[model samples]
Target: MARIKLSCERGRSIELDTARTALGCIDFQADFVLPEGRAGALGLPIEVLLAALPAAQRALSAAREAGMFVFFTRECYAPDLSDLNAFRRQYDVAIGSPGPLGRFLVKGERGTEVIADMRPRDGEPVIDKAGFSAFHQTTLDTVLRVRGIDTLLLMGYTTQCCVASTLRQAVDLGYACILLADACAAYDPADHEATVRVMYSEGDNFGWVSDSQRLADASQSIEH
Candidate 1:
C-alpha cells in the first residue's frame, strides 16, 4: 500500500477523500465516557470525558453526512473472562472486580454498550474488541480492507490509551490517520494535551491531529 503523506504542520489544510476514508470512534462506551460509569466511580476524571461528548457527536455526524464509512469500537471481553488479558485481569481485580460494571467491559453489560448519543446507526458495524487497539484480535483490519478504506479519522474516549493505540497501529498497517483531538479525552488534562501534541508533532509517523470542528468542517465540505 502506498502512503498518503500529509504534513502535520500547524494550520495545514487536509483534503480527506470520503471513499477512501472511514471514521472510527474508539471505546466510546458508557463505561468510559459517562459521568456515572466505571471510570468515574473509580475516581478517574469524568469532566474531560463529558467535555468531549459534543465534539465527538459533531465529528460523527459530519462523517455520516459526508458518506464515509463510520465504524464504532468498544473494548469488551467474554463474560467467562476467557478473552481477558493478564494485565486487564489484574487491573479489573484492582478495581474491586469491576464493581458494578461487569468486570471491565464484559459483553452485553449495560456499561459495555455504546453511549446513547453516539450509538451506531442501522447498518454501521459496532466492532467488539478485546484490547486497546481495535486491530488486536479483532476484524477491524479486514472490515476496512474489504471496504477499501485507506484513511481513517479517529475520535473517542481516552486519548492516551485506546485512541492512541489504534492510531499507532493504523499507521503501521498503512492507513493514513487523522486523530480528532477535541473529540477524545483522557483522565488527566495534561496527558490529553500531551498525547495530541506528540501525534501532531510526528507528521505522518503515527498520524496527524486536528480538532473536532476542523474535521467536521472538512468532512461536511464538498470534495470537488
Candidate 2:
C-alpha cells in the first residue's frame, strides 16, 4: 500500500495509507455553516464557520485526487422528530423549527443538506446522522469498514461539537484519526482552539491533530 507521512502536533507524525484512509467531513450542512441558515437565524456567529470553507474545499479536493474514500455527514432528524433524542429535544429548540432554510436540522430539508461550496461528489457516501457523533445510529462505521478504511481524516463545522464528538467516537472505534484544524470552526474561537489543544494534548491521546494545508500538500505529493 502507498503511504504518506502526515506531520502532527507535538512534533509527531503518522503514516497514512492512501488505500486504507478515508476523509470524513462532519456536519458541513447549511444549518451549521451557512450565513443564511439556522445558525444565522438563531443569531449565532456563522462567519467563523464560513471562514473554514476554503481550507475544507482544498482538503476535499486533495482527498479526491489522492483516491482516498471520501464521505460526508449531515446532522439531521426525521421530519416527525421521532428520531430525535430527549436530550437534544430539550436543548435544541430549533431542531424542527422553521428557519430561513426550511426546517432546521430536519431530514430532507434544505438546511440539512451539505453546503454547496463543499458538496460531496457523486458516489461519495453522505451519511445522515441524528446526533453529533456521526457513528451514532448511522451507517458510517459499516460503510468505512466495508471499504477497508482504518484511518480517518476529519474536518468540518463546529470543532467543539460535531467534529470533536465524531473524532472521539472514531478513536474509540479504533480508527486512526487525524483532525484538520483549519478546516473546522466553532461559534467561539476560544472553543475551537480549546478543542484543538485537547485533541493534541496528552501525547494525542484522542487522535492526531493537523491542519488542512498540510494534509492537502501531503496528499498532492502522493504518486498516483
Candidate 3:
C-alpha cells in the first residue's frame, strides 16, 4: 500500500491505501446541524455542519459507488439515561442540547433522526452507541468484522470527542482509518483543528486523517 503523506495541516497528507470497507458517519442529526434544531439558530458553528452536508453526501455516494459499506453511528441513550455513562451524564443537557441523555436524537426522536441530506441508503449500517467510542458498548467492531471490513472512512460531529475517540479505536483494532476532515465539524474551530493536528502528528497512535476530495477521488478509483 502506497501511503500518501500530506503536510501537518492535513494529517501530513498520509496516503493510506487499505482494504477499506465501511464509511462511518457520526452524529449527522438535525439538532446538531440544522437551524431548526435550536443550536444552529443560535449562531453556533456546530450549526454550520449543514454546510458540509453536500460534501459528506458526495463522499458517502462515492464510497457506496465503490461498493463499500456505509455505517451511521449516533449517541442515543435510553429514555431514563439507562445506557448513558458517567461522562455523558456528567452534565444536564436540556432536551435540545445535542446530548443523548439530557435530550437529543434518540432511537425514535425526530431530533435524533438522521438529517434528510444524508439519509442512509439501503443495506447501510445505522448503528447506535451511547458513549464517545462507537465500538465501546456497541456491536460496531463485530459487525464490521462480520462484513469483512478493514478500512474505515470516518465523518461526523464534535471532532475532538466522538470522532477522535473512534479514530483511536479504529487504529487500535488494526483497521485503517481515514478521517473526512472537511466533512466533519465541531462546536469550535479550535477543537476541530486540534483534533486533526493530533491525528496526523500523533500518527498511527490516533489513526490518519484525510480530506473529502481525496477520499472521493480514491473512492471513485476503487473497483468495488
Candidate 4:
C-alpha cells in the first residue's frame, strides 16, 4: 500500500494508507443543508452550509476512485425522541418539533436524510447518530474497526459542531484524522476558521487540517 502524505497547518503533514483510510461525511442531512430544513427555519444561513457541497462532492468522488471506505452520518433522533438527551432536549426546543421537512431531526423524516447530491451509494454505511459526535451511541467506531480503517478523512456540515466533535472523538479512539477544511462549513465563517485553527494547533493535536484538493492530488499521485 502506497502512503500519501498530506500537508497540514503550521508546517505539519500526515501520511495515509488509502486502504486503511475512510471518508466520513458527517451530518450532511437536509435539516442542516437545505433552505427548507431545520437549520434555515432556525435562522441559520443554509447557503453558507451549502457552499461546501461542491468540495465535498469532489472529495467523495476522489475517495471512491481511490477505493477508500466511505461512510456518512446523520444527526437524528427517533420519532418518539427516545434517543434524545436531556441537555439537547432542553437546549433546543426544536429537536422533535414539527417543521417544513417533518419533525426536526427526527428519523424517517425527509430532513434527516442526506441531501440528494451527497447521498450515499449502495454499500456505503449511513450512520444515524443522536448526539453531536458520530461515535456517541452509534456504530461508527465499530464499523471503522471492522473494516480495518485506522485513518479518516472527515468532511461535512457545521465544522464547529458535529465535525469538530467527531474529529475529537476519532482522535481519542486512536484514528489518525484529517479534516477536509473546504469540505466542511459552519453558519459563521469565523467559526469554521476557528475550528480549523484549533485542529492544526498544538502540534496538530486534534487532527491534521487539509483541504479536499490536496487530498485528491495526494491520492491520485499514489494511484499512479
- The C-alpha lDDT values of all candidates are 0.80, 0.88, 0.72, 0.89
Q: Summarize candidate 2's per-residue lDDT along 12-103 as a digit string, tens digits.
A: 88899988999999888888877788788778988888888999989898888888999998988899999999997899787899989898
Expressed as tens digits, the lDDT of each residue in 88-123 for candidate 3 is: 567746533444222564566666777888889788
Highest lDDT model number: 4
Candidate 1 local distance difference test against the native: 0.80
Ten-residue region with minimum lDDT total, candidate 2: 215-224
Say which prediction, candidate 1 or candidate 2, comes out ahead on lDDT.
2
lDDT-sorted candidate list, best first: 4, 2, 1, 3
What pairs collide in candidate 2?
none
Assess the local accuracy of residue 71 in candidate 1 as a C-alpha lDDT between 0 and 100: 92
Candidate 1 deviant stretches above 4 angstroms: 1-9, 91-98, 202-204
lDDT string for model 1 (1-224, tens) is: 11222333476646666777889988888878676778878788788888999999998887787788999998887888788788877765632246456655888887888989998999889999888899999989999999899889898878899998999899899998888888999888888888887875644457677766766566545543
Off by over 4 Å in 4: none
Candidate 3 residues lying further than 4 Å off, grouped into runs, are 1-19, 41-43, 95-105, 202-204, 222-224
lDDT for residue 200 in candidate 1, whole number 0-100: 57
Candidate 2's TM-score: 0.96
